[model samples]
Target: MTCSIFFSTELPNDRPQVSGALPRAPQRWTMEWCVKTPDGRTHINNSRTIQRATVAEVNAIMATTINGIKAEIGDLATFISGRLTSHGGTRKNRKGGKRR
Candidate 1:
């Protein structure tokens, strides 16, 4: 399943009615993300929220999350590259020509 994450500038008006853990620590704002699967169904059946005191902190968290995702994609690319090259396979360019 392919999944993507995005930060919304506006809160969803028709959010699903679900309760989550309240922020226990000192925090002024909460950032939320909804994970949806194919057919437009929520993956977790609920929105995930994280509490942070400042927008910078939330942005930092988002950056870290994005970086982690990039790392995972890199690993997957490496694995696929190894597999493709394992059986004497050659890399192909967009024009279907062998890549140097």
Candidate 2:
């Protein structure tokens, strides 16, 4: 099984809305996936998530889940690197110029 994905969110209703158009802490995540083997295997998948958050919850996913996925797809170096940066990464853009 091979999977690739991206996830992030920034909401104006910063306080944390439990429901409705005005959400309190609405979040979002999207994933694209496929499973395959030349011999006898193939699969496909996708998903999204919008919900609340605690600092710890996000951190745990960053620390644990991200690393776990990298290890799982350890053979795919270039693909994993770009996928992690583009999707699973958490780098805030800086004001002045370059990398943050």
Candidate 3:
């Protein structure tokens, strides 16, 4: 399994500012994660937009997300391995033939 994390900033579009009013804040930042298989095919892709966040906050969020992904992958691997072992690492065809 492979994974990637990306961080980016988003700027607001050019527009006339109103007089005597606080300026609009930029969209701020976006964080994205992509999980891929060993074959280089994408398995999961997700993103979140953050506003007015500090670097520390971003890092915390990223770490948590990564840990969650790791746990999920581990659980899936365990389940698959258990199933394979239960079947003696062999599969049966419709014609009662054993398949590896």
Top-scoring candidate (TM-score) = 3
Each model's TM-score, in the order given?
0.29, 0.28, 0.40
Q: Candidate 1, residues 1-100: lDDT per residue as tens digits?
A: 1112234223366222323333334344333433333344432212223433333454466556535544744533211100000011233556856556
For residues 1-100, write the lDDT of model 2, one tens digit per residue. 1123233223343222222232224234343434343344443444433444333354344445445654775534232211111123333685776653
User: What lDDT tens digits, residue by residue, belong to model 3 across residues 9-100?
Assistant: 22135222222322133223345555554555555444554455443465576667756876877633211100000001123455756545
Specify the poorest-scoring 10-residue window by lDDT in model 2: 77-86
Task: Output the number of the lDDT-best candidate.
Answer: 3
Decreasing TM-score order of the candidates: 3, 1, 2
Better of 2 and 3 by lDDT: 3
lDDT at 46, model 3: 47
TM-score-wise, the better of 1 and 2 is: 1
Given candidate 1, what's the lDDT at residue 26? 35
Clashes counted in candidate 3 amount to 0
Superposition TM-score, candidate 2 onto the true structure: 0.28
